[model samples]
Target: MSIKEQVRQLWKTCFDDDDAFIDLYFRLRYTDKINKVIEEDGKVISALQMIPYPMTFCGQTVATSYISGACTHPDYRARGAMRRLLQETHRAMFAEGVMFATLIPAEEWLKGYYARSGYATCFHYGLVKKVINSYEQPVDNSVSCLNMSKIDLLKTPQERIYPYFYEQMNRRPCCVQHTPDDFHVVLSDLALSKGDVWIVDKNGVMSGLVFCLMDGNTLSVKEILLSDEADFAEVLRQLAASYRAERLECIVPRADEMHELGMARLIDVASCLKVFSAVYRGEGLYIRVTGDEAIPQNNGYYTVLPGKVSRDMQEGQTYVTFTISELTAFILHDLHPYMSLMLN
Candidate 1:
C-alpha cells in the first residue's frame, strides 16, 4: 500500500474519532514540508509523521521541527515499527539540515525509549500560577499594571513594547529562541476571539507582558515576562480578574529563580517533582550532542538534559553523542520509548 493509505489505516485503528483521525492524517500527509513512513502487512498497521526539522523550527531562520501524531497499532507494537520510523525520520531530518525537533511525550515509558536512540533530557518545566478573584489598588510605591488587551500591536507604543520585552527575557538562563514573527504567531493563536496579550505598565511604560490562551475552563500561559517579582504577581491578579478564569497557569523554565518563589503560590511542588522524577530515569549517563545551534540549558547542566537521562556516578556507563535534532526528539518524546528502555 502507499504511504497515505498506510497512515489512514493506522489512524483508524488507533483513534476512535473519525474526524480527529482524518484531521491528523491530512495534517501529517499534506504538510508538504514533512516526510511520511508506513509499516504494513496485508494492510497498513503503523505509521510515522515527520517534517524536516530545519523547516519546521524556522531552522533556516531558527533550528528545529515540531513532531506530532506518531503512533503504532496494537497488532504491530512489538514489531519495532516505532523504532524503525524514528530512526529513519532522524536520518532524514539530519540530512535536511534540521538541527533539532520537539514534541510532548505521550507516556512515561516513552522517555527511556528515546535514550537508547542517543537522545538526552534537556529541561523540564510546568504551567503554574495563582488565581485571584480581585485586584488590589496600587499603593503609593506599588508598580503600575496595564492590560495588553487594551493596547494595539500596530500602534507605535505597542511596537516599542516588544523590543524591551525581548531585552528583559533574553537575559534569562533558560529562555527559548523567539523573534518578532514568533511573538506574532503566538499572539494570533492565543487571540482566537478573546484578547490574549496583557502588558504590565510601570510609570506609563511597558514593563512586561503575559502571553496566554483560553481553552474552555483553563488559561494556558506560555510565558510571563516581567522586570521584577512584584510586577509579575500583580500581573497575575489583573489577568485573572480580566479573564474571569478560575485558574491561571504558565509554563516556566526550571532554572528560573522567580519560578521557585512563585511555585508555592502557583503549584504543589511535591506533585510536580514526583511526576518529573518518575518520567526522568536516565541519570548519570553522559552524552555529547553536535548541531549547528545550541539549546543553552542542555549545554552545561547534568540535571537539565531535556529528557529523564541524568549523570550516572557509577564507575562505568556508556557515553553517547547525538545530533541536536535527535536530542530535541528525546526531550519532546517524539522518538520511540522502547529505544531508550535500555538506557534506564
Candidate 2:
C-alpha cells in the first residue's frame, strides 16, 4: 500500500470518526505534501499534517501551520515517535518561514502533552444558548434568507457569499483567515455533518451570515458574522424555528467566560515581535526569551521599537525575561484572538 493508505489505516486505528467523515477528510483536506509520517519496516507508524493557513496578526497576514490529524499507532505510543516527529516538524516550519504553529488538542490530557512542546493555550470561545420566546417579530421571509449546504456551495454563485465571508473573517483583530480553498473544505465538512450556512439580507443588502450544524434537537453554530445593523436575535429565532430545534447554541468569541479551543506556538520570534511592535507602535521594550528548546533560534534577547524588532542587547536597557509560553501569552494578551470554522 501507498503512504496515503498507510496513514489512512493509522488514522482509522487512532480516531473514532465515522467512515464517511474519514472519507470526506481524506478527499478534501489531505495531501501528500502536507503529510508527515514516521515509518518502521516501511509501514507508517505515526503521522500528522502541517496544513498551511493565514492568520491576521498585528494588522498583517502572517503564515501559520496548523497541525492536523495528529495520531500515532497504538503500538508506537510512548515510544517518542510523536515527540521526535513534532520536533522535526517545528524545525521544518521555522525554516519555511512559518510564523506560528497551531493545533487543537484531541483530548484534555493532550494539552499538557503539547505544552511540553512549546504550545501555549491561547484560542478561546464562549457558548451562547438561546430559546426563542413568543412575541418576537417573526422571520421575514421577504428578507431573502437562504440556507446553503454542500450542494448549494457547488451550485450557488460563490461570488455572492465568498467576498462577504472574506471581509467578515478578516475583520477580526486576531483570527485565522481562511482562503477560498479552506472555506470550501469547511463548508464541505459542515455538509458532511448535515450543516447549513444561513445568509440573511435586509432590504436586499447582505447583513447576517451563520454557519451551523444540527444534532438531534439542537442547532450548534460554528460561527456567525453580521453587519452593524443585523439583528442576531431575529436570526436565532429563524434558525430555531426552521430546524425545529428547541435549543440553539452559538459559539462566540469572548475574552472571559470561554473554554479553551486551541493552542499556539510562536515559531519565528523576531518576526512576531516585529508584528507586535508594528501594531503597538511607539512602544519601546526589551525582551529575553528562554525555554524554547524545540526552536532554539527563538531563545535570545530582543529589542522592540516603533515598527521594528531586532535581536540585540543594549547597555543598561532593562529587559523582561520570559519563557516561550510566557512570551506567547504576553504578546497575544488583550488581542481577543479567535479561530473557528476549523472543522475541529
Mark the regions of model 1 whose C-alpha exceeds 4 Å error after superposition.
Answer: 1-30, 39-45, 51-62, 126-128, 131-147, 150-195, 199-207, 214-219, 227-230, 255-344
Colliding residue pairs in candidate 2 = none
How many clashes in each candidate? 26, 0
Candidate 1 residue lDDT tens string, 223-327? 767766335655666666566666777666542332211000001112222233444454444555444232222332133232443433334545466454354
- TM-score, cand. 1: 0.55
lDDT of each: 0.48, 0.84
Worst lDDT window (10 residues) for model 1? 335-344
Q: Which candidate is the best by lDDT?
A: 2
> Native-vs-model 2 lDDT?
0.84
For residues 33-82, could you state the per-residue lDDT of candidate 2 as single tens digits? 99999998779999999999999998899999999999999987998999
